[model samples]
Target: MSMFIRVKRKKTTYFLHCDPSETVLEIKQKLQALSENHVDDQRLILIANKLVLEDHKTLADQKVENDAIVAMTLKIRETGDWEEVVIDKPGEHPKPDTDAS
Candidate 1:
């Protein structure tokens, strides 16, 4: 039988069905696409009854049944603001007004 999994991130949430053998990464990737967001180097965690799901751990490994409720929280990271670069006009230099000389 197929299992239904729920993922919550920020103010968004998603649901998907998977086989019992599906990994947490699979759910993470699917939720990322659904929310149109990119995952940072730090990964999301899946918890069921206060248990931390491992990377190589699958739902089947945790004995997750169908219609499981999963909790997702973001990993805090130190990030800086984006810098903008202003480019000068291509090969255009100011010349002295010698025409009137």
Candidate 2:
């Protein structure tokens, strides 16, 4: 089965869906590769929307599964609280068709 990771960017959160078998590092690389704007490693910090994402830690270690929200913080929030977003939601997007490329 595959899993989904939620990466929180500046004022927004991004969703990355990948194989559950993949490691955290793999996911980080994938995020950078897929991002429209360049994403630096120094800016990448994993923070679960509900909990914490250990550094260099794989998703499997947390017993995470499909459609999970794996929050990734790019920059330190302004309120000094990285718990909640300062802006609005990134908005819902239609799922990419599996039949298409």
Candidate 3:
């Protein structure tokens, strides 16, 4: 059975019918095809209890269930530099931190 997953990107929320057997990179590839971003630049941040997901892991291994929402941030290369974009939800203001750990 296909799992129903929701992906939030900036102001847009996309609902995807995904197979649990598929890897995280595969999902990122689909996102690349649907959006203006490239697959290599995509970063699928696993939001299940604030855990970071690896690209090679499958959705089932991540415990992603139906109707789960996945938050993604993109690292796009523009004009000879890489820009990291964090798509915050509405009414949430976050302070910018320059500390890279």
Predicted structure with the largest TM-score when compared to the true one? 3
- Best candidate (score: lDDT): 3
Give per-candidate clash totals: 0, 2, 0
Tell me the spans in candidate 3 whose CA falls farther than 4 Å from its real position.
76-101
Query: What are the models' TM-scores?
Result: 0.61, 0.52, 0.73
**Which ranking of candidates, highest TM-score first?**
3, 1, 2
Alpha-carbon runs more than 4 Å astray in model 1:
39-48, 79-101
How far residue 22's Cα lies from its native spot in candidate 1, in Å, is: 1.0
Which residue pairs of candidate 1 clash?
Answer: none
Q: How close is candidate 2 to the true structure, as a TM-score?
A: 0.52
Better of 2 and 3 by lDDT: 3
Is candidate 1 or 3 superior in TM-score?
A: 3
What range of 10 consecutive residues in model 2 has the weakest lDDT sum? 37-46
- Candidate 1 structure quality by residue, lDDT tens digits, 11-51: 44567878878777776677667765444432444445645
For model 1 the TM-score comes to 0.61
lDDT of 3 by residue, 6-97 (tens): 88867877788899998988888888878867777766665666555678999899888888878777664465433444566877877788
Full-model lDDT for every candidate: 0.60, 0.57, 0.76
Q: Which stretches of candidate 2 lie over 4 Å from their true place?
A: 10-13, 36-50, 75-87, 90-101
lDDT per residue, candidate 2, 1-101, as tens digits? 66676666555666787776666667767777766433333233334445555546667776666656555554434554443433245554566779954
